[model samples]
Target: MFAVGFGANHFIPLLQVYREGMASSEASLTAMVGVYAAGLIPALLYFGRLSDQIGRKSVLMPGLWVALVGTLILALGAFSQEWPLYLGRIIIGVSVGMGMACGAAWIKQLSTDDPVAGPRRATVAVSAGFGLGPLISGVIAEFAPAPDFLPYVIHAAVTLCALWWLRAAPETQEGRGVGKRKIVPPVVFTAAYLLAIVAWAPWTFGAPTTAFVTNPSQIGIDSAFPTLVQGLLAFLTMFSSLFIQPVVAKLLANGPRWLALAALGLTTTAAGLGVAVAAALTGSVWLMLITAPVLGTAYGIFMVAGLAETERFADDGELGALVGIFYSLTYLGFFVPFLISMLVTGAENVFGMDPTQAYVGVLAVGVVVCLASIWPVSKAAGYGGRS
Candidate 1:
């Protein structure tokens, strides 16, 4: 699961390198990521259900195999610098979709010792992978030869180790029988889910696109710096999730407060991103780094909070279905950048703004969207209830 995240996100900062190194169009750059989400969304829905019947390891090992292949393809793409990049991303997306859906469920089932232990470990593994992937890629891309090629090679090696671990791991779902299940959205998951989804949108989907759209290269920063900055964006967002989970757990120990905290997380992400955008507009790497802790904390808080809320609404029969649905919705954030890239292009042509300015405009709009939700989210969280 951790390797899945590592491979999935490691390519984020490399978008800049691909753009400049190969002279790829901005549209193609964003499309690369968009197509990934396109592949992942469907795979999540399909595979999560499939795992129930076939057992966890059946789904998990294959997913890791596919991920290993996908990583190799990505490395080849970096070497060849052509359609392979697109193909690699789509393949990786599919692999991650399977890995995340099945791997998380597997972790939960195996954690019979403690209920909370499963989620905590799974979240940390994934979050740490998400944060470190880009940072690892960026460091290699910055300092090493064949920057693009080398990073994927390292990831491929890591994927092999994951495969080995999965093979040795025990199968937790033994007595369960395979049955067909439909992914109907739960009734209890209404406005609250929507609010959480909205709150999560900015970071899960918005951050990477915003970072690349406001490309530091446009403002005369070295090519490597943009890569580092983009990596930092991911590093902070995910790492914060890892670091802050325990704190969030302690803070929201009672009631349905996680939903409210999720809302607050989104609100903070919006505000912090606004400052980060301003920093981007000025080509100030320092300012961008400053915003990392805030973004990371928000992601950590909102993600766990939202998950806690979702767990409450799930019935045992359809717990996996609900988890699948929740994740599928959140993963929609992956495509947000692609759509924003298109909008940024339009804004450049129609509004006469540079990429940085257009990104700032988009981010400012995001802030408004997040701000508007606070009241409703608070209300849903029973803000005025017995304190």
Candidate 2:
């Protein structure tokens, strides 16, 4: 599970480096980031059901092997042309899709009847892995011998260890019948459940995901230190997830869950405004640092709470299917960056605003979405209290 996330993220700090190395356009670099979803979404949709039918180990082992291959492909790209990089991202995405679906379920099965413990453990592992991957990669790339080549080499070694460790883990799905499991969106959910999902939804499309990779230059950061900056941002995000989630979970347990989400949404909106202001004020990078706390806390709470709410509403028969759908929807945020980039470019041309303003302008749309979610949040709170 950890390897799944680590492999997916280890390349982010290298995006700018790759761009300069390959003389690639921003559009192509953006495509490489967005292309991850291209493979991940479909693999998640299929493997979620497939894992239920076969077994966790059956899905996980193969996924690990595929991810190893993807890591190698990415390493090869440091010496080759651009295509291998994008292709590597896609293959890594596919492996993540499978690992998330099967690995979470497997963890749940091993949790000895503690529902909360299972998903919580899996979420933390993934979040930590995702956070640490870029941090490790960036440090190595910045100080180590083979900037592009060595990071992947280290990850390749980690991947092998994870693959070997899986051999002794027990399989959960023994003798389960294979049946047709289609991803049908839930037509009905209690108001609280709906709010929990909606409140967290914007985290996917919001700034935290994009700023580190795309907007670093707008904050007056130099090209030579992008790896350090990216690594710092990744750590902020990961640390926030690790530290804030339990606090938010405790708050939700004590009070209205919907209110917690509402607060998170407002924090995110404030962070977006901060980004705009930082850019306007001569790109004050320190002020711009607000993106991490707001986005990270919101993402952490939303994900953990949203999964809990979804599980509350889901039927036992379709647990795997529901989780798959939930993940797919969450990941849909990956597309938001590409779509917003297009709009930002257009707005820049039409209104003559700078990249920072354009970035914030798009974020305004997300703010509206966050505010509009308050109604559902209210409903979710009411429902959670009663049931």
Highest-scoring model, TM-score: 2
Poorly placed runs, candidate 2 (over 4 Å): 185-202, 205-207, 217-220, 252-254, 257-281, 381-387
lDDT of 1 by residue, 341-387 (tens): 67777899999998878877877787787777677666655222112
lDDT of each: 0.69, 0.69
Worst 10 residues of 1 by lDDT: 211-220
The per-residue C-alpha lDDT of model 1 at residue 85 equals 83
lDDT of 2 by residue, 282-313 (tens): 65556545666556666676666555655565
Relative to the unseen true structure, what is the C-alpha lDDT of residue 79 in candidate 2, on a scale of 0 to 100? 83
Error of model 2, residue 264, in angstroms: 3.5
TM-score of 2: 0.89
TM of each candidate vs. truth: 0.88, 0.89
Error of 2 at 192 (Å): 8.3
